[model samples]
Target: MENKKERYQVALVSEDQKINEDINFFLEDRFHIDVFSNGVVLYNHLTKEPDKYDFILSVSGLTGVHGLPLKETIHKLGFSHIPFFLVVDKADNDMIQICIQNGITDIFIKPLDKITLQTRLDFQLKHPVVGWKKRKQEDKGFNSYKMPFVKRVFDLLVAGTVLLILSPLFLIVALLIKLESKGPVVYYSYRVGTGYNIFKFYKFRSMFTGADAKLHQLKHLNQYSTEKQEPSDLEPERQEVKELCEFCEQAGGGCLRPLYDDNQIVCEKIFNARKKSDKESAFIKIKDDPRVTKVGKFIRNTSIDELPQLWNVIKGDMSLVGNRPLPLYEAEKITTDKYSLRFLGPAGITGLWQVEKRGRGEMSEEERLSLDNDYVKNFSVWFDLKILLRTIPALFQSENV
Candidate 1:
């Protein structure tokens, strides 16, 4: 018999009683479990007894606190040493990438296999997640992309010269941005680049202040937003189209996929399948976006807003010619096996996609990913030079992408 003191202590947080009960049933034999109904309560308890658990397992969506935000809070509160695992109903590629980017120690999909859960927990017990470490794609069998020495030297030389000569233009742009908007001159956001590496990406402030906070509200304006199909009045058709996942809805199991919930309790997998069938593009792009200021519009049209990225190139976050680095949300959506090859090459300011399809006004997400993958598979210094030369003429083409 195992001694009570020898068992690992676990904290499980979930609002679903059935889920809590099911997880407890699977884990009770091997670990000591303390359950919390929400993240706030667990956080409060941890404050008083920080060392009470060796690991934390929480549902993605909570009543008082969401999983990703709670993890951010935990890190901010200096609890970065504790292993934190996220529990989701379905483990979609996008969700997995998002969780890993946010430093989740591990993720467990719903209808959790007992043996797999036990094995994972046992391993985590022996080697607890210590400091919050960024997870990379090395273990997934992709070699980390390294910039060639010639490319690196070229980037440094070009970026250095551009910053030197364009220093005056940058100041002028900064003044115009500050005069036009009430925010800082430069905007910076986290971007995922080669090998799934996250870095701070910079650009001159083109959109209005607080543009990011309003992104969700303005998703309807996205050029890539799919038109939803109105349900047919035919009963048989509606019945046939009713989305129900095998393990989630059809099996009468509790809701496992929460990301796609349409306020109707539909599983994420089912909802995503519906969206996929509808041909929704995961990439969001808006033409003539309402968020851009007049100054923003002018700078963006001339590609002057992109100049600050020279600093990023100088810092080795990117190269002069490669696939453009993507925003976090965009990166998450494309992390599936079909599109992940894009990340195995250098991320950059301009590349094959930009030169080939920037002003075409009809580049689909699949085409863009395909172009990026092609670049990754056959990039060389000579090819980079050709791309750089092509970019010079297209630099001032105004598409308002």
Candidate 2:
């Protein structure tokens, strides 16, 4: 028998009694478990006895104390070093990404299986980032998505089937992108993935070549507002960009009668438009970001532009379903433990974030972060496929995919 000192001390912050009981059943065999129904009681207990557990698992949508906000307060009070494994039952891609970046050590979905639960706990005990991943493989009961190897087969099958069916459309898109844009058809980018690993993400180029070079000049959008702001350059830019959008009505060719006077009329209108557009609107979004080109807008709306990421899934850089990958700057917004939990899975192509609260022309860093946490806590393969299936409907609604 292993020494009790070597055993992991885990604090499960879950409101659901069945889940708590189930977790205890699987964990009792290998861990010294202390479970609580909510964050307040657990937090108070921690205050009373400062260092009892080796790791902490914080569940999103808990009773009384909400998920991400609770994490922010906990980190603020300087209990940050204690590992926090986040739990989510309902969340989107962006929310999960923020969680991993914040500091969440790990994440688990509800109705966790016996083996998976043990695997995660044991892994964490020896390799605890936040909670423990149990090393010893012991199964005393029914598995949720039982058969680890079978799960892998399903993932491959789904990935393969999607790839085969979408091949023609993928080709057509590639050609159209090449024909429409001067740059490469598929824009490959170095993005961070699970374990902070860097992987190349593919997307239909929505911006012109040297687009990144222009980001510095276009950062002017960030100059808007920030009472609801954090310490991020990206925050300011979002507002600034949204502020700059009044001209979009004109840019998108919306709400204006076309005049055939001359090119000078176009230029004059464009100039006047930019100046007048610099105002706060009811719907915090820039309708016509001067940055997006005609092709860019179309690509964004049709959702065709995002299709290239399927290749990322094929290559195993990402999963068919999981949290969205963070573009370096976006990842920095998360500054708490609950944030890191989002990064636990292989980054995904279409995620809970996009299907639920997509860029919709106006989503905040905080809102995205919260949703990411929720997704992480509630991740599952079945859930992933279901989200992917529902995603097709959203493509029609998307301005740019």
Candidate 3:
């Protein structure tokens, strides 16, 4: 069967009809364009189908509900992963900075010539909203350094290489895990990785065989770290999620809800354990987790368990260097502002602060923000190399590496 051509829908909202039409006329050859007189109308469509378009273009200087308002609204919607462009005059530096701070797609300046708009548009299409999409396209493969590439390539390469060279140590650990526990050899976790997609992360099984099932039972103890306690809505959508074993155990699919769809063959949801946080958006770690097995502690502490992610790098599930991939629970924080731009690129094995302050855990989300932002702004292949070298000695001092 022939595959359907991918659809690329775009929105352009501007006060000037001439400019709007010009953009439309120019873009028609390339995309499915939707023109709006202002941000209001465009926002309406977006709200209806948050993922409706491939891109959104909001021009500056709308008298009421300016560009910033529309962008913030999208941010609130938490669909900040969608690619969006800002149209403005070059003199609008303040607005540009605000857009940058919020992680808006690059800008399109006023009096935008066909060449520039097309160029910027090309870049957006080139860098899709997620990793799976990027790898699917013909963009250049991974670079160990730079902006276009994720920031932690250096860390990944360094760590992955070391692990491969020290495979015998991992073998010893594997044997110890077997000697110490009666369980599966590896712990396969369905974690939310780069692109917010779930992947089975491999680690020498550090926890007990059924640790996950006991998490709820341990909730009271785990809840002690209120600072780490996720917001109310962060848990699995239990009403919606079909528990694997329970579902299989039930005679009639465990009695579904009113909104159940007969057509959704499985109708099972794996609501990620890591729900994106709803706060200022700076949590990427699962702290002092009770689900961690005794063997898990040694691997996690020595940072030996992350070796499996090297497969992610080879398979392009992640980059060697970039922002560390946060679980969905960590998403809201990055998208919210603490490190908004940090989410713009791929998740990494090690990144800016990972080599520097990740070990001490001394840096606040803000400090991490500064380092990540600097990486994005000044990213390059060589820069990745420098970070890679800086990471060598620092790995001993850090837990993230």
Candidate 4:
């Protein structure tokens, strides 16, 4: 008697009913497909029965919860060992780069080519990702027998001494904060740190009470917001581009091919025209923000706002030198696994980026993240000391804090 081959279990997440049907029809014969509509449902199911599925296939921009964020959640849940494949409508250079960073096994762009997908699936199955070797290697030094101990001891000694000496200054700052603001003197911010750990990050309140409520009013002041033209302003140009796209599609060319190909003169012209209209920057900075109070300006400029974080360091919520802990909103933006490596090291009030750039308005978001990754990859006791020394000078620099 011959033994029957065991079928591979695959989980498919897509909000589109038609896409789900198509994927199921194509894959059901060879694999057991568990279909889900949104990332939340899929995530809950996976958490309960992670071992049931061999891999996951998800749509990139699902409505309820997006794929990249879903992947981040999975990693946080300690289920990163499972492989993921994302399906996208049009894979641009940025999207492809993001996918690569997120540890996606493969990307299947729409008008899904069934044959190519099958081949890719077969290849992935044959070569399953046993572990994230690169991330492991980057983290190895920090995780070694002696480094963590040495790092913690240094944090204790330094943070302890600073708190003791700064106690009087802390009292003065607390009183000033109370006189200026109606809210608590110390702002306890919710921040995401190493390994997706959540902690209350301490800082002096550098903005007026209810400042967060005024964010919408200040959107125009956000330096990172991409400049936009009113729809009416761009309608004619958009129609022209639409016609060009249709022409290319009719001429046996892909709708997205022109956008991806720099050699396409027509495409390049239209793209450049559109590019000139949209001014985008990744880093957000507002010149002389009105949200800050008079005392707030002084504290932020002199880096006094960061003093209360010494308590967090002593409490073991952070280290003296590591990646800066991110607010939940900011952390959510960094969903890619490659960018997530920034979380492998400890969260700190000051790190390589702070020492190197001192909140220079010129630093791009990617550059900042890269510095965090660099610190993780090359962290040592001596390196930390050097960064600490450099931080002293940076504290006096008159730049955006």
Candidate 5:
């Protein structure tokens, strides 16, 4: 006696009922298809029963909790074993790059080609993703593209030429820095770069001597610090406030009773928490910081402080165009595989984000990280050249130091 073959389980997420029906009709013979209208429902179902589906096919532009973000969520939740594909009406190069970065298995364009779709689906099903080999190949290719012999020659030539031409300016800046502040003319910090490689990054000193010692005193002025609120009696009815007060009392912690009427119990608490951990903000910046010397302000605003980094490029610690390297503190926070993708390319003096958002102060931290990831995914030699050209104009823009 022969046994019946079991159908492969697939979860389909799309808002359009007709499209869902068509996909079901095509795949039902080989797959036990489950349909979902939005990402939220699909996510909930997957969370409850992660092993229920062997594959996920979602529309790119679903209304509540869109496909790309949901894919990221799934990846973050360690659901990389199941293959995920996106069906899109249209997708640009940037969108495609983002999809690839998020580990999307494949993208199917709408006005669906039934035959091609079936062929692709069948191929992917037969060849399940085995290990990290594919992802490593992609990273290896990106890293190779970023550090070709030609690029190395370009970096050496450009950095050498720039350093030679700017020697007089460097001397003048060093003199100014020495005359104004009692410290070394150049600043060096340990920075993490490609492959999480640690190297000493150079820059002209842009703050006062012993400025680091005063960081604790000026932490309140840190632009990136998570804001904390002093609890008050007005919010006493809130359960969180009550619980905090109870915790404080039991822990023998200080209370904000002095500021409240009738000596009501109140406990200070952090509010509007930062999305990133404190360690991730190792490179803190403050606008109009008091720690900067007179010469420091001028050099930083005009980007003269960045000149010494040409030496770093010459030493092969950085490139002319790539993602900015992070400080060790910040690098430690990106230990996860997905976030670590930013390290697949060489570190740079000026990169995609710096050129794209020049003089734009409203960019969020997540947006900056996304730009770095995008650069790692899409960068080529020509792309690097374009970024370098764009950076020349951006130098005069009013960007942060």
Candidate 6:
């Protein structure tokens, strides 16, 4: 007798009863489906147990929410590896491109092909997407760079000495943090490090208790986003002119924008309109972030906020000098082949990127990732010492202010 296949948990969101029924008819046998009427309800359910669902299925345009922003939020919360499939009413090139850019796994147009959909879903289940946990276990021998004995010795010595000497300072900072904020003195979060290893990264708390919850709301203030698109003289004129589609000519105006989908023209004004989220920068770095307390600002500027990471270094989660470990959200964005090289090196408290452009706030995402790769290529005891020396000067300077 053939063994029964495991039923994967799926979260399907749609208000259209017929669509949900149609999808259930095809997938229920192989998957356990939990239906949600809207994205907001699904999102709340997801936050409680982000790893519960094997995958997610949602309509292209949710009842009250747009699909792309929801995907972005899910990725930002460190659940990017979950396969999120979008079902659109019709095939739309612009919607497809946007979905691809945001890392949606697949798209299915209306009147889904049962054979094609089932085959793709089965294939995905058999070969599931790798998350950080699996990557850490499987890639260790092949991808992780073994720390040299001398390097490990140096990290321990330096980290130990600094932490011991700064004990009094740590106490003072902790007191200040407590006095200024209602949160814990130290902020710890899951950060992706060398070889895609996830670890609890610690820092002196520099913001309020719920600062992280406010991150998405404050995305508009990101300094990096401001630089994503340079101002052009013709931008004003471009926004005013609603380009007409020759394929859908009318008296007043044709389609605002025409997008080709499988050789068919789709006049989608709804999808084409400029959205505030589209302006959000891939990298999040806000100048004078409002969430920061007065004590937070002082610690951040003086580099005191990062001092707590010495504990991480001593605990073997990082090194004194290597590529800085990235938060889960930032790390997820750079997992493409071109940028994955950064993970082969050690996670660090201070590194080449910090030394090169610590407070300039001008380094683009590409430049930062390239510098990380560069450090991975040239890292040595001597190279690390040079970077350590450079870090002292960089810490004292803050052109970003």
Q: Give the per-residue lDDT digits (tens) of candidate 1, residues 1-401.
A: 96565777888876678877888888887678888764545555665676678888887632114476667655543465677888765556756776778777888877778887888888877776653333211122446577789999999999999999999999999999988889889879877788656788999999988888766655556666666334343322211224557776555756555452212234456666675555446678877788999999999888899999999999999998888888755664453566778988999999999899877686777788999999998899999999999888787676788
Tell me the tens digit of each residue's lDDT in model 5 across 259-314. Answer: 11112322333211322442224335566888888988888877788888899899
Write one digit per residue (lDDT tens) for candidate 2, span 249-354.
5477442322111111222244346532432211123335566667778878777677777677667777767667765444433334666566555577777777
| Angstrom error at residue 205, model 3 | 3.2
- Candidate 5 runs further than 4 Å off: 1-146, 225-283, 399-401
Assess each prediction's global lDDT (C-alpha) against the native: 0.74, 0.58, 0.57, 0.70, 0.70, 0.73
**RMSD to the native, candidate 1?**
10.5
Q: How accurate is candidate 1 locally (lDDT)?
A: 0.74
Clashing pairs in 5: none
What are the clash counts of all predictions, listed in order? 1, 49, 22, 0, 0, 0
* lDDT value, candidate 6, whole model: 0.73
| TM-score on alpha carbons, each prediction | 0.64, 0.47, 0.45, 0.61, 0.53, 0.63
**Candidate 2 at 367: error in angstroms?**
1.7
lDDT of 3 by residue, 170-237 (tens): 78888888887788776665444433334555667777677766654544333212244433424433
lDDT of 4 by residue, 61-147 (tens): 421134666676666555566678887655567557756777777778877777877788777777766665444343322121123
Of candidates 5 and 3, the better by TM-score: 5
Higher-ranked by lDDT: 2 or 5: 5
User: Using TM-score as the measure, which candidate wins?
Assistant: 1
Q: Which residue segments of model 2 deviate by more than 4 Å?
A: 1-151, 220-287, 359-361, 398-401
Q: Which candidate, 1 or 5, would have the higher TM-score against the true structure? A: 1
Instruction: Summarize candidate 6's per-residue lDDT along 1-401 as a digit string, tens digits.
Output: 99988888888877678888888888878888899864444544665676689888886542114366557655544566778888775545655676777778888888887787788888887776556346324431324379899999999998999889999999999999998769789989877777666778999999888888877766656666643444333322213224554444664555645543322343455334533244234468877788889999888888999998998988999999989887655664454456778888999988999988877757766788889999998888999999999998888876643
Q: Give me the candidate number with maximum lDDT.
A: 1
Indicate the TM-score of model 1: 0.64
Q: Arrange candidates by lDDT, descending.
A: 1, 6, 4, 5, 2, 3
